[model samples]
Target: MTLSISARFAFETDQPTDVLLQFEAAAIPEQRIGKANTSLTQAEHCARVPAEDDIGERIWLRSQGRFDVEYSAEVTIERLLPDLGTLEALSPHEMPGEAVKYMLDSRYCPADSFQSFVEGEFGGTLGGARVDAIRQWIADHFDYAPGSSHVNTTARDSFIERRGICRDFAHVLVTLARASTIPARYVACYAPRVEPQDFHAVAEVFLADPTVEGGGAWHIVDATGMADPAFTAKIGVGRDAADVSFLTSFGPSNFLFSEVRVEKL
Candidate 1:
């Protein structure tokens, strides 16, 4: 499937501010790209930084006064959904070195705090069954309220409040999976049919497949149930939202407006 994605950001700053932006589609093996462009108004000293995951790329820029940035891309992506029934949770020692980190706690997803709860609820279930149960549990309990969660909201906070956005949902799911000894990570994506047409957050779990030689594969999971896997374009992967935020500013900058549009072709 091919998708056209575009985003615009406007900000106002009293003095020059340094900004790090990760708004581009990731260059994963499953995705192909055509012509793409990015522009920044009233900005100086812009540079591109390769992401640690070797997937998405980030842009750093310095801007003063009124600043505007627009990015547009044409991408074709192949969605690969895992066969849940054939997946199993691997032991910590069996997991790859890179996958081991995801099983640990992060800033937003404190897996240790939820160990008892996760074990009590999902101890008996293993593999894809456990993942499906976790997804359903979150979707059933949490209310998808936009203004209910803040940047500092953690999985425990969202669990107690029973409300949050896509990122919050992903955080809670990732935490619970990790608590159950499952390797899970957060994913930033451009999802089609998202009501608000904004960047989306999802989760991916490394499930052990008997057929695979080493260990297993990362399976895309959306606890929020808002994104269509077939139309989603991955932007980045990380332990949590902190590592994959679309934009970050070092100095105080008033966000004027932002907009995202995705079209299927």
Candidate 2:
């Protein structure tokens, strides 16, 4: 069975920003059963109406953006539980649970940073509790305020600051995940609910086939909505937020006023 959902996405930035919009998924992820597609106007202001073949699982429109400017992408999710085993086996020691060497080597994710409170206290490997721990920590420690940090805010900065937006939250998670020997990546996209799409962040962990979760193995964890209830729908994932940031402007510009409004429609 599959489910279908349609929504509109819109946003404004504080300054003139170039944006890169992504709305594509490798395949369905985890329990998310079916797939859906989208249609939009030429100007990319509105999402016409989405279409779906089967109707069952939680199907909805997702988007991602950055500071570039006006940008958007319409994506569909087909087959929620994708065969991540292949990717898991192929990915190097970039994420968690695969290798401590690479994780330790990373200047961003040091060995000391990962703690028992993250592993034993949390639960299993990065695939299990790592993502949750980061989410909980960010929610508990940080304050949801923009302008706290700029685009250059590093993982360490966010951790020490304990106050940032979605991008900062994702960087912190990525840093921690790497410390735990988990091959983690970054993702950026839009969360479409009642209103338009807005920028969001998340982390992904690569693990071997455990002979469980239906497939031989799978990658799990979406921190975008972990701290906040507003970001419900999943949109995209990558090596980091930078990889998925929409709108890459060529020249220099300035921002007049930027704002984002989202509501279920």
Candidate 3:
């Protein structure tokens, strides 16, 4: 499959400011089965084109001064790839304790409160009656509110605060899954149900049971439960929100605003 995408950004500055725009533009590199190939494309300070291997893409901008800016990104991910069986074999009764430890201690996400919450709440397997329980637990705990907190907000804080965007919800889920000893990752993309023309966040769980289908493959889950299979476009994945933030800056940012528009053309 092939797709095309474009985004527009508008920034109003109180004063002239230096800007460095960085967006997603890399092709999905071919990878071995049972492993996810999610990485960011290095984009210059302007428009970008899809790479030869890209099935999905993203666009972003970074400015280097204090000013008001509005930016929009357009992304198209096509060539819907089928999931090949990659799940590993494991006992169904086991919890994801090991996975969680790695994630909290890992450099990807270092929030201490987040680590503790996962260890406390993530205490079961995904099979049998626990699957629904896991889903319900996530859904009941968080509310969807974009821009409620800065990116640095910890999962524990977001949970306590009880309000955040999809990224925060996804982060909590990813952390919980990992803490439970299950392999989980962060997914960045747009969910049509929430709003087709905007970006959102989702979590993916990687099952370790070989007997199950797609053992090591990623399974998309939305804590917000706000997606339609029809309009959701996945961009990339990583340990947490920090990994797949469509727009990342090297220095600092202030009074930032973002918009996204995705439509079939």
Candidate 4:
């Protein structure tokens, strides 16, 4: 399936600010890019860098005065979602070195802190079923309130509050999976049919053992229940949202407005 994405960002600055942007689709094995373009106004000293794990590209720029930026892209993504019952979680020793980091605690996803609860709830559950249960548990308990969470909100806080946005949902799920000894990571993506039309957050679990009909793969899940795996376009992957923010400014800058749009083609 092909997806078209467009985003606009405006910032009002008193002096000058340096910004790091990660709005482009990831160059992963499952995604093929057709075309992409970006434009910046009142910006200079621009450069590009690849994100960790090759998940996406980041652009760095210096903006002065009233700054405006726009990005557009068209990409084709191939998603293979296997039956939940047909996959098995891999043991820590069996997981690859790269996957090991995801199983550990991060800034937003403090898996170690939730060890007791996760073990009590999902220790006996196996494979993708465990992940599905976690997702459902979050959806049933948490309220999807927009301003309920901030950048400093951690999984523990969200679990206690029972409310947050997509990133908070992803953080809690990621923490629960890691606490259950499953390798999971946070994903930033362009989600089709998302209410309010903004960048979306999702989670991916690495399944190491598979049934005859199901292969070992990274299965995507949206705890917010706002995205379909087949239609979502991945932008970046990280231990948590801290590593995949769409825009990070070094200097002080006030946000004027932002808009995002995604459509299936």
Candidate 5:
């Protein structure tokens, strides 16, 4: 499948400020990029650096006065994912150094806090089955209320409130998966059919790599069921949304407006 994505946002500044931008579709083996371009206005200084896992790049800039950003790209996805039920789990000792950290606690996920809940709620299921169960549980119980959560919302908060946006759903999925001894990370991406049309977030878990010997693989899951892994184009991966937010400013700034469009081509 192919997708065309465009992300544009405006920011007003009283003075000069530093900003980090990360809203481009990643160029990985599974996704091919074409006709990609990005433009920044009023940037006194600008540079690009690699994002987490080298999946994408982040744009660092010094913006003065009013600024605007526009990014557009065409991406084709060629990926195949295994059935979660058929994939077996691997021991912690068998996990790679990179995967191990995802299983640990983070600011938003706080996987350790959910360990007891996981044991009680999903004791019978293991490996990918457990992951699927967690995803289904979230889908069945939570409400997709847009304004129900705020910036400081955590997985526990969402679990209790039983509602949140895409990022909140992703956070809860990551927390529950990690609590179940699965290494799960957060993902920022663009997908064709997300309602209200905005940047999307999902969870990616590390499981057995049936393709390689004694190796592990990462699979993407969307507890919100808003974005399908087969059609989603990732921006990057992080411990939580804090790490892969599309834009982060170091100083105070006024938010203007944002426009995001993703469509099948």
Candidate 6:
């Protein structure tokens, strides 16, 4: 399937502020970028940097004063996602080196804290089954309340609050998967049908699957359940949202506005 994305945001800064951005659809094996265009109003310097695992690129820009950004892209995604309940979890010892870092606790996703929770709530389930259960638990128990969470909000925070936005939901799923010994990472992407659509995030877990080329494959698990995996176009993967945020400013700034639109083409 193909997707069209259009995003625009503006802000004002005091000095020459350093900013990092990761907002383009990644050109990975399963997703291909057909065309992309980006424009900055007052960028003094801008360069492209590889994102985590080199799955995508981030923009490094230095600018000051009021700034405006416009980005648009067309992407085609060709992934045959399997049922999350049908995939099996792999043993930690069997995981590849690249998947090890994702299994550890991260800034936004403290996997260690959720160890007992998973063991107790999902004791009988293993592998993909446990992931499905976790996702379901979150969707059933929490509310997708916009403005309910801030940038500093973590998985533990959202757990106690029982509410958060897409980033919070993704963080919770990533934390739970790691605590369950499944290599999980956060994903930044664009998808159609997201309520009040803007930027979107989801969790991807490494699972054992014989049908794929490798012994294991990564499967998307959206706790919010708003974005379907097969139709989702991933922008990048990271330990958490911090690593894949569309914008990260280095100094004080006033965010004026942001608008995002995603649609199936």
- Best-fitting candidate, measured by lDDT? 5
Q: Model 2: per-residue lDDT, tens digit, 118-221?
A: 56644553444555566566677777567788867777777778877777777777777666556565554344432223455665555655554423232444
lDDT of 1 by residue, 87-197 (tens): 777878888788988999999999998989987887778888899899999998999999899989999999999999999999999999998889999999998788788
Task: Return the top candidate by TM-score.
Answer: 5
lDDT of 1 at 233: 89
Q: Quote model 4's TM-score.
A: 0.94
TM-score per model over all chains = 0.95, 0.54, 0.61, 0.94, 0.98, 0.97
Error of 1 at 203 (Å): 0.8
* Alpha-carbon RMSD, each predicted model: 1.5, 9.3, 7.6, 1.9, 0.9, 1.2
lDDT computed for candidate 2: 0.46
- Tens-digit lDDT track of model 5 for 180-218: 999999999999889999999999999898888788899
lDDT of candidate 1? 0.87
* Model 3 Cα lDDT, one tens digit per residue, 139-224: 88666776798867866667679787777777776666555545566777655456435667777665544444534334566778
Error in Å for residue 151 of model 5: 1.1
Q: After superposition, how far is residue 238 of candidate 6 from its true place, in Å?
A: 0.7
Instruction: Please identify model 5 stretches exceeding 4 Å from their true place.
Output: none
List lDDT for all candidates, in order: 0.87, 0.46, 0.51, 0.86, 0.92, 0.91
Instruction: Rank candidates, TM-score, best first.
Output: 5, 6, 1, 4, 3, 2
Counted clashes in each candidate structure: 0, 52, 30, 0, 0, 1
After TM-score superposition, the amount by which residue 12's alpha carbon in candidate 2 deviates from its true location, in angstroms, is 14
On residues 1-265, what C-alpha lDDT tens digit does candidate 4 reach at each position?
9999998988877777788888888878788888998887856678889996887889888877787889899989876666765578776777778888998999998888788997788777887888988988998999999999887999999999999999999999999988888898999999778998998999998885453333346789889999989899999988999999988888888888889999999
